[model samples]
Target: MSPARAATSVVDVVAAALRERILDGDLPPGERLVEGALAADHDVARHTVRAALRVLAAERLVVVEPHRGARVAALEAGDVTALYELRTALEVEAAHLALSRHEGRLPPAVHEAAASLAARCRVGDPRWVRVSEAHTDLHAAIVRASGARRIIEAHGALAQETRLFLLRIRPHLGYARLASEHEELVADLERVGPRALRAHLRASAAVLVDQLA
Candidate 1:
């Protein structure tokens, strides 16, 4: 790779590591991200660390202010509301489209995602980051089944943002409840219908909003 491209690649790698740490709660919200410390820990130059932080800032996973450096982004009630509102709209439509496209039979990916999530739910106090990823994968499968390429692409970014927010509000969601909900969602898609799935999404969103409040 070219010199510039190599630097970009390193930044991506460092940023992903930091992102996982943030989502896994190793670095809690509002924790200051020291560039020099990160550089030493990651064995990269300070400039590379700065670049990585900038990439995270673009994703809204980190916040940077003049002279203050970067920190894990602190979420507000409004942020939660906006993210869920848009997420709900996209996911509800994806469910409907997937059903319409597949004639009520879910795609294989959807089933796999559901099974993975169900298993994770059975684990006691499963990590918030893993739960968030499994949940997003389940929804992404639904969107992929819709065969709407653009919607699938859009939902990918939403899925990441959803995971970020979920990390913050995971205290409100129980492992048992998450497992049961996924189980119910899979059953509803098979037997009941899209309306049931939509209701489930809205209800889940409401719980998150309440927790944030």
Candidate 2:
């Protein structure tokens, strides 16, 4: 109701709209996001647009540079490698914890997530973004199975970046392969433990980095 609160709410709405556009590939990487144009389009003040850009920048979805203004963040090979390195560390550990905690059986949620992803892939023509979302959900489910709050929180932080990276690489990886590989990983996790997950992450990182190159 207050003026300040109202302004903050507008900023959130604007930022969320922009975020969805970027993540959905409607606003491709390197596309400039001019504050003046966005302000006019969204019917908000320039300062509000500026604040919305800041929110996206914090998520690494936008790059705000001096004079050049803001643009959708470009995917770099180095960033891909770095993200996967962190993912390997967090996810592999999560897999270990999950297997140990559940007496070598994965939680039912993991199977459910995998099934959901497989079903999505079975569609006649799957939207890459939807497939990517399902892929992310399956991995998040694996992390959740760990029941380690800190591990879950850490992996959750990477979700957006992971989705972005996956989107870029999905074409190269193929929808069917993505679904099959994850299903295989989940099936083998109990027998092989974290090794399966580490291998999966490392392989994906290699593919993405190669594509970016």
The TM-scores, one per candidate, come to 0.90, 0.91
Query: Could you give candidate 1's per-residue lDDT for residues 14-125 as a string of tens digits?
Result: 9999988988889988999999999999999999999999988878889989999999998777887787777777777888888888888888889999899988777876
lDDT of 2 by residue, 75-149 (tens): 899999899889998999999999999999899999999999999998998776677788889999999999999
Clashing pairs in 2: none
In order, candidate lDDTs are 0.82, 0.89
- Shift in Å, residue 151, candidate 2: 1.5
Candidate 2 Cα outliers beyond 4 Å, as residue runs: 1-5
| Candidate 2 global CA lDDT score | 0.89
* Residue 96 lDDT in candidate 1: 83
Q: Considering every candidate listed, which one attains the maximal TM-score?
A: 2
